[model samples]
Target: MSPPSQFSSLPKDLEWLILARVPKRLYPILACVSKNLLSLVRSPEIHKTRSSLGKDSVYICFMHKNDDGVGHTSHWFTLRRTKNNPSTEENQLVSVDDLTFPDHAEPMPSIIACGPEIFFISGSYVPSSTVWIFDSRTDEFRRGPSMNVEHSFKCVGLVGSKIYVVGGYRNDKIHQAESFDLKTQTWELTPSPDEERLAFSTANVSLDRKVCGFMYLAAITICYDPRDGSCEVFDLPKDRWWETGVCVMDNVLYVYYARLGLMWYDTELGLWRVVNGLDDMKKVRSVAMGEYYGKMAFLWEDSACVGCAMKEVWCRMIGLVRSEEGGIVGNAEPAQLMGSVPSGYRLQHCLSVSE
Candidate 1:
């Protein structure tokens, strides 16, 4: 027989299902229940929630543009794990590559993944060049396709087997976006929007509650919709992009942007709401948030160095909190959520999102 729970009618499996979507901060609160509930904390099914994690904490790489070309494109730095069990102390930044770049390969990569295993996408900083993939954990490099004939930031979007390389410059007219498929491992030029978009970003919010998929941005801020071959921009005054957040099920595209140190999102209403940060929370940049170990967690770039944007950052831990409304908050530190969560275990979700 199961122990006492607020959800008495819920089957054990159903209970785990609900707890799986709960955030890290809320886990401690939930853990206070009976021992049976506590034991369920370690169950595999709860942690097996993959689609939720992937959608929330989109695995993205840290990228920057060099004013004076000297580094590897911009992602010269790559994050590497220090030791299996990260201590309660903050994860100090570690360099991924042990090799020195040749002069020609000076500008290596501007983008790198925040999580482990999936490594950095090193692209050509110069014109007519091939991009490379470097595994920070193993410190190895594999050459990728030449980025769209020009050296500009590629706003990347990945859905299942395909990777979308959106609007970027190639020294000519600001080129539109293109799509690359991992299955076939090939690039196909998609339809472009009416107007040429530069420095704009593409974010995904799944329309269905389960099984993550893609949706379009139709806010005032002009965004290029490749499917429609139309140049559309969301109103900057309304809302632009959102910061670390979850995926939405509503047919409308809910976009969040990390601008001005706050997590603001433009729902279908076309207004940006300032999701004021928690007392200790800064802008949840880069790293994603989602269920980790039967509880929700927030992941972000741990910038250990000052003044150096190229410095490789590691995934630091944080907990997430949900409210009566669907709103979410993030908080994480060792000895906090799942105080019993083994230090050796690294819980990462697809991207940060609130259930």
Candidate 2:
């Protein structure tokens, strides 16, 4: 397609706004249209504005074994309202065509989302600490530098342009922590957590504002401040940390337990509280948990036996809210069914991309 001069005729500020609001998938094509548009598309200010304006959709990504259960594959999908049922609030998750990860990408690799880009960090099982990055803007995948040390099932957190990965290998605990510099496209070893003796594989990490946070060994929550290069350890009321997942939203750290309930920590107050309306979820398995809009969202897996040798697995979305008294009030909206994974295949990891 030929470049259009009409966009240039518009005012510069208006053009910037229009360009930033467009879908990320169109950036590559738009960049090919004109040099000015390309410059604006690659600018840091435009991306910053786009994120602030909420102009991006949230995509939920998962890795599961293929139908035969012989090999693994990963898929990226997003929830969108069905066109025919415009009045209904229900939404459906639609997969992106050809968005699957490389066959070499193994199951349970840690996934992190930075703006429009999703980074897949796989290691140990693979040849090395392989990194695969998917940029929604181009809808393409590119390889990144291998980590200095091999690790897998590690907890990841993003602080500024660097993504910190910790505790993938038990034997390498003393030096398992590493940071990936997005600007330089390289990995550098960082200081291990305060308590490296604890099993790092079981812990979960997230970034709250500028501080890098981690929930480790069930009772300890570590906060690493990059600005001052300081680390603080906080004791949790609960003796054991759940494997459900951990995420940061609105500057708060949320940790979910598969059996008990969802617990959240207030960074400013330094206190933890259990979300109130989750009695029904105590028995169900939590596949993944993350933030949707401003509410707490989780992917739940339900199992049932229908007189068959194997059980049936179901997946659904649940949104929780916090009341004034620090209780989980109720669902922010009706739970939506997102369909189930194939038999013998289970959800390994879940992350949301705002692009």
Candidate 3:
């Protein structure tokens, strides 16, 4: 076999390797030189083969300010992991408006969530908040039933198949959080018992993953003991909010997280100590869930912002000490998976968000 002859000239596989190693800027030149190269780069098969998982990645939405009073679909963009490392505008964003259902009607991106095979985004420039289901694979967004309430919607999210909505206001005294179940096609509105405590802005950011404590308390892992108002917990396995722990500032459980094993808030003693080891963080925005080198942990975005504001987001990686289920980290997911600006592509000395 004599070492396969001259490596570079001997085979087509070697040619692809040579081309792959070449600077990407040279790709345009490569394509220009031959029609075959152009077809290869444009091949849909190439993209399909690269990833067969369907598009399960989380997509973030922003209210893109535009010339029109109601923004156009073209302004709505989605970011995903890319091999090219996201530099150019094309790499940074993929317009999902076109992928929406084949209706010429306007697309108001709202109520974004990552379901198993779809990202549900619904909103309306009109008084009614319309729900839209987007199929990432088909890139089509289909309009669903319109919300009955008239005021306008502030926030929306989902736990499993149930969609929860908390609002801005219809009139006065309409303080409520509405729950809609897609599986049953049933819509139920509950006068938000907690409306007095959380205002409109709070409701708008209500679904924001940060402010909620993710320990064993409220909704995700273990049942939260609502007996103590101090904290909010989600038992993930059961997929419901529980009343286990309470809130805490310092050692006082200003917020309770039962799963993290937080039991008490020493406001009377006025001291703060982890009655349970879950006393890591009091708040967070978005989180990433995965095993880091077989150890579960979290990466997060401290604040929530729309558009490609990863440049504005504060990205942090927290090493979580895993329990039986998964690791926890606050402000974690969006920043690492989709938000942060790519190295060398984004300038380091960007100005502060407020500035």
Candidate 4:
């Protein structure tokens, strides 16, 4: 009799259980091994199993110009760790060449991650109502239901099952704010603030079950609670805030300031407290921060590559701990060179998606 296949030896349930434990970053490599493994990796059941086991992985996705010198053509890449030296902590960014945004999609679309999917809301000089969803598991893109109103230069926040899009240029005031229901895959208009015109938001995050939109230049923050459809506007703690480096981790709002390093907002105290550690790290001129799994991931350009044709992007993963005195302390790993991009490519967005 012919020998049984290795995959066929185990029960399908048991095989799924084993595969669910594999890190998502290695899924692409696994998919290339065989059709059976590829099917398993792309299967919804495997992802559901991984979610049940709390094995979600964080991936860093960023965009840059394609080397063809075609202006406005952007290429996407995911920063992954190099496996050549598994014992070391070095990591590298690999290009996901197969994946590219729709030609009409904005170069710097407003992006928000929901589970294994990343939603790219359309934006351009003229507002567009297109929404593109990227599935990390299958490495495929699908068109999602468009938003209620055409918006550009918007900020997005994910609260529960719905994604809240706020503060963007739109034709009408009634639909300036809206939410997309992931479960139903429908868009609905939400209440906007009392202001006749909403100021453009630089960054947004979900905290305390509310969507908070920040306007850095104006030093104002608009907090909208979907539960009651009420909006509250407050002044930011700092006169000048870094617009791009704001993220929420463990339900706490963290913002990185050039002068202050990393700081977390204390909602109860209504103040920004400097993280205890990271005093020894050098200052970065620009940074994009995101929540990587349970830790804070900071992406910045390597200052050493001043005149180089390709600039290196460095990433530092920081673990936050609560001290006995009720203060926050950060344990940061030495920065590693994630990879390099063209000198002209700006770090537009850095976000973590769990798969």
Task: Please state the error at residue 177 of candidate 1 in Å.
Answer: 3.0
- Model 4, range 1-355, lDDT digits (tens) per residue? 1123687578888877887777565565677777878887766577556545645444554445666855465556665434574223455677777667774536667778787788888865557789899897788999999887787666678887799877565555434578998789899988764542233576678888788878777777777777656777766666457676788876788888887788887877777889998898778756788765446778887645567788878888788888898789998998888777777776656667665
What is the per-residue lDDT of model 1 for residues 143-246, given as tens digits with 9 covering 90 to 100? Answer: 66664545344444443345555555655656655665655767777765455543343333222111121222433334444566554444533334333344
For model 2, what is the error of residue 116's alpha carbon versus the real structure, in angstroms, after optimal superposition?
A: 1.8
Structural similarity to truth (TM-score) of each candidate: 0.50, 0.66, 0.41, 0.77
lDDT tens per residue, model 2, 144-223? 77888777545567876788876555454444477888779888877665544232444345546333434445567666
Deviation in angstroms for 226 in model 3? 12
Q: Which is the winner by TM-score between candidate 1 and candidate 2?
A: 2
Q: Per-residue lDDT of 1-355 in model 3, one digit per residue for the tens?
A: 1222343244554454344444332344556656656654334332232223222132433333345665443323444335464321122334455644343354543333433333333433334545566555565666665555643434444444456555445455543556667777666764452333222221111222222323333233211111221223332333222221222111112222223332333333433333324344444423322221111133233433444444432322223232353322222222233344321121101000000
State residue 225's C-alpha deviation in candidate 1, in Å.
2.8
User: Quick one: best TM-score, which candidate?
Assistant: 4
Full ranking by lDDT? 4, 2, 1, 3
